[model samples]
Target: MWPLRQMLQPRHVLPIHFDNIIRINILMMQVKYCAGKNIPFFAQNGGSGWAALNLTNGIIIDILPLNKVTFNTDKTQATIGGGVSVAEAMAAGAAAGAFILTGNCDCVGALGAYLGGGYGNLMGAYGFGVDNIISFNLVNAEGELKTVTEASDPDLFWAVRGAGPNFGIVTSAVIKSYPDSNLTAWSTALVFPGEQITDVVKAVEALRPNLKPSQNVFLYLTNNNGPVILVTGFLLHATVEEGKAAFAGLYALNPVFENSGVLPYAQWNAGAASFCLREQRKPGHSVGISQLHPEQWQEIWDRYVEFRNKPGAENSVVIIEIYNLAKGRSIPSSTASWPHRDVNAQAIVIPWYTDASLDNDAIAFAQKVRNIWKSTETKSTTYINFAQGDEGLEAIYGDSLPRLQTLKRKYDPENRFNQWFNIQ
Candidate 1:
């Protein structure tokens, strides 16, 4: 047996040289070797995953070397490397006068989010990140590199889009892009008093049916120096008047603090920069809901206030992401493995602290907030990317769980890639 210290760290790491096809293929073969020896291996991306992962006595494949983003001549499609961040992709798209669907944070791994059914500001118009994937250059469990497209291999394609980490390592992917000569969005940040939680929730609910394809919004109960309820709204390709008209309900609330402006596509995720800080203990609990209940949201605000009062946990946050689902729902549900097409809102409670002693308290607080949201949900569902790992296969995979299990057996029978939300 390996020494405890050595076992705690990856056995090997080939960082800078692991970019090309030859190196990627060799890495896959090494993965197969690890599987044969009953040793574990993991692919490390932007290091944004908050799940508790066990990589002891395993190989950590640092995919950062594969960071490359290249767009086609017409700027309609771009190939994104596995290690690329959402910010990098957006920067590349902005440079090319195009837009690609990516998550809200600047530091999140592009492929990591895309594989788990990507959610972003552009999702209101373009659909989820998975919907834009043209093809994936994947190295499967058996050490074989193959190109996966809907037509090339239907089941594998479907399975990978939602549960890619469970099956293989995606070296790179070709994704659809939209060219916009004017790639700017009008965005606003609003702050409300804690007492206005019910009013804020009601405003969001009232605005839901009127949401446009170019609009999205996020509500938060968080600490900005101190506890405050915040709302961030985005409208793509819109002027100040157009944006204000679209989000009239929120404007009517008369927030205590407000900042509104137009931002380039590359700077769209700037507001989340503070939350993108790495190396802190941030265990997140999230759920999907069909409707926003004023009472439940008020309760959530109360719970957040209680938890945020904890000395070192002031940064903890409760957030609800609301998107226009018309464009995304227009696509058939069976088109991919993402199961929450019917969900109208996604909520997450992030309890952030560095003290190991606060683990139990934080977990309890997050779970309690999640329970409040779950009470309003008719079906238990969560976006895989937002899942907190203990939600079980059914919660993350939804109706796609059974079929995914079959594919897992056929492809990764020994469960080599079992780190993130493993398919059991």
Candidate 2:
């Protein structure tokens, strides 16, 4: 039986990590063995931990168990199995007195997220998740496993950083890690009543530069019975007092709620994860922008207010994240296929719909807002990680289209791994 045919039948299944290429081979052999007797089998890794999986037919190989972590004593590099979660990677890095740029959401897969240009709270300080990746152990289109690096396969390495899933399945990744220190981090939430959006915007803009490199600020617009302003920011410093002093200007805004303090790195990671916990069933879409001018903020605010007034809009959320980009853009654009290297802010408009019947209208509303933002004079770029499935490839790649396409054609002419945020 062919690989595809054996994979399609449902039979005894095994749950192993994607990094365990040997196990995958064993499972394949098992399937072949079963096929000899005309039996059917299938497997899957059903947790939300996977960043991306083969939604098409065939056996679903669970890569979560293949998690094995190792690190270099120099503190500049670490190796992680593809099945490792962002939280697991962080924990391992912390244990080694090192850290890697990762997403705030702990459940996201490390390899998949990093390869897909993952960004998170530390992005302002490091860069996209892909930037920290040094090399990868990948299973190519032909199932021949190989180690791809900047020197070994320059083009393939470049493509893998931003678009790896398109070329092949990565078994493990060797990534650059940062020194782990007891960095002081705090979260501040400011509240402004409905009519004070302009003031809030001005205050945020004013505090932008004052915010140290260790800080991340995000704006939340919601209509939970009434319009309110919530500015949540994280200040990373050597000490809690220092972080507080550095972000004093923001706290001076007299937020309705303040929860700023110091905690262990693990606790901080957990806190960050808590903020992203929302109902998964709610229809949602997100788009990131390079930057938004003050005038553009007004237009966005107006649409936000309009959406708030629409029926079934009570749970709508419009998040505007203004984080530092100096660290991320410091790397030359030519170094990787990932774009949005110079973006300073990311705007995500999420209009939630609880009723399934209202899905079409809710999606239309989200698209309309996205279109308005895309048509703006700001000329911002879209972040591939947050992009919705409906968006065209051109919209995501923008100026980087030619290079990405060239690399895509060269590495994945057949496009076997075209599952996530595909270029085509």
Candidate 3:
């Protein structure tokens, strides 16, 4: 089953025909046909999800043709097609002089990320991607198109904001956009030798409590030629000096390599383009942590170094993403189904490799890292987007499990849209 799931990914190589869904009506028709026939189906978003799926036998609905992004006249809102990638939305937002809350990566589907509690660089300032959404153009289990908004359907709207894929297929979404006529951000990439892991981790811990809403930092234990600690700090609407001051704790460490500059909003994600490469067996595991333990991170770095040296596995990366959740936390947890508002940090390990022979090795290494993270975690949880499909409902949905389950029974009794994180 694992091998079959792996083969189903990198879908281009499979000898199967897909129904290209370009319009909402067409997508609805396909859904109804598959539901009536009792044939399982999965909708392809950005084609970037690395979770293990049971697409053993199903028709793939190619929603890539639905990719479209348009902003309103005042650049205050955007109508994003379900297939739009983060890169597409970012480019469109840049052209329209607005800032859209999107994931940090470029290739992930914008709506797909939003559906799982969107965490992005701008989330500290604006809010989660789910918070920005105004309404959805959803196609339900019965293949009926429904315009869902807070005023129209509060329950389904709340469900779709966090656990959408399990309820229906959203053809398009209307999301709040901010006008950013001056859309420049300051960012720096800092590299440290593996030996500096403790100092780096401690410095990050010291800075975490002081993180401003306009600032965010990402830490990566990856192979840059060899095992190295990479840190990228970003400050929105700030000068270079301000960016430096915000991350002064890290700068005090005197990194081996440093590159800092102010970039246009369009180029904020340029550094992450390399991570967006498609079609590799990237089985990623993640956890939401309430605190950062420096000693544990040192151990993680040691383990990362050991696995990174393996042949054909140097692309594996361990990333920790931290943000100021004050704004997102300001919103009530009951407002939507996303359950990780109080989590201080999110960590993920991607065991990237293409050799089928190394599948077991990669999974072992990833699980080991996840276990290490869980050992020190006060409350074990995982962001739905970063999950690898091995978690229980409590771990993924947190306290929202009971309500989401009830909504699942109400909205999708037959469980047709169970491709991602199913409610039941």
Candidate 4:
């Protein structure tokens, strides 16, 4: 067997030319183990918090090399390896004349995204990523491989759709695909004086209900030396004229910088990615709320302004993303382990700090903002995907706590795969 010392080296240093040598060494080492023995392994791709948690026990499955995905010609379904990235899946789906519900971050893993309750630009038109999955190829805690679907092992299937990672290791999944449609997406930015925060909120409140199922609107409160209001809207229209007409009302808000036109699906996604790319000044954090009341919005806005004016709060940005809930709300609450489907709106606050000295202050500020919202009767919920490592189990699970705990008892009584977003 190869020396364990060599395997302990950092994987990032492995050269492409020496990959064959490494693979051969691994193959030779495997021969020494017994046929039915189940050896623990480490699994991670992008090394984000989502993946790093798997290495907590120092034993991960290391599924990054297993990346491979295929889509059928019928456009009915596609199977993706656990390690596949959102970018990789998008390219493959485009080639196959189909697409699946995926996140905006191209680096997010397909399995990790869905298992964590994936939300994306297209979620308003489709649904949560977990809702589209048809089946899963899972390796249970006992090292037994099983194919789980609605018709077979219905309970496990339901759990896997939203609560899989907490139960077992999901090696891959087959998800429903939609026929590729050429889309016309447009973007517009309005910059109002910082003092007009109330006006901006009023505009958003008026526009929220008018948004069509095929459109998505996001508003960001930012400051680069000074405060500014920015609004971006995307439409999944079949024609440029239709997109223009659909966005006319919103555009009439008198955007300072507007770029509205037709683009291919690939271009639209790329543009979306570019707009979302922000400097990694510090450890990023966010919070979620199920609904946004007008009074709550005003209170949150006041908090944001106050926080921005504080010392060492220059680069921070507060983002607001609004998408149609018609599609997601249509699904039964029990269809998946994901809760909070019936809420009208969702909001998240993201703040940044450069120096370690300011880290505590930043966290305190975020917590204070969260507390302000929770203290009210809103009882806002948190999305597991955006959760910081320290959030409580009840906060992330919401009303589905009992069902998730029950699945934990059945599939992973020993808690072998309990690293990622663990219940206990």
Measured on C-alpha atoms, candidate 2 has an lDDT of 0.64
Worst 10 residues of 4 by lDDT: 1-10
Taking every candidate in turn, the Cα RMSD to the unseen true structure, in Å, is 3.2, 5.8, 2.7, 6.0
Query: Which tens-of-lDDT digit does each residue in 248-281 have in candidate 3?
Result: 9999999999999999987989998877775567
Against the true structure, whose lDDT is highest? 3
lDDT of 4 by residue, 193-278 (tens): 55556666667766677778867777777774665777667777546567656656555656566666666555555644532333
Residue-pair clashes per prediction, in order, are 0, 8, 0, 8
CA lDDT of each prediction against the hidden true structure: 0.84, 0.64, 0.86, 0.62
TM-score of each: 0.95, 0.82, 0.95, 0.81
Residue 123's lDDT within candidate 3 is 94
Name the runs in model 4 displaced over 4 angstroms. 1-42, 49-57, 181-184, 223-226, 238-241, 244-249, 271-290, 294-315
Give the per-residue lDDT digits (tens) of candidate 2, residues 1-424: 0111112233334565344656656544544543455332222221332122334343444667757778887878889887787788878877877767777667667776787677776776787788888889876655556888899988888877776756766768888787856543566556666566776777777777555676778888875466677777776644667766666765666666666666555555664453344333233445665444555666666777776676666667777777777787788887888766666666766665445566566677667777665765366456666665566666566666787778777766665456556665
Which ten-residue region of model 2 has the weakest summed lDDT? 1-10
Tell me the spans in candidate 3 whose CA falls farther than 4 Å from its real position: 1-6, 9-22
> Residue 245 deviation, candidate 3, in Å?
1.1
Candidate 2 off by > 4 Å: 1-14, 17-21, 24-60, 223-227, 272-279, 293-315, 378-380
RMSD of candidate 1 to the true fold? 3.2
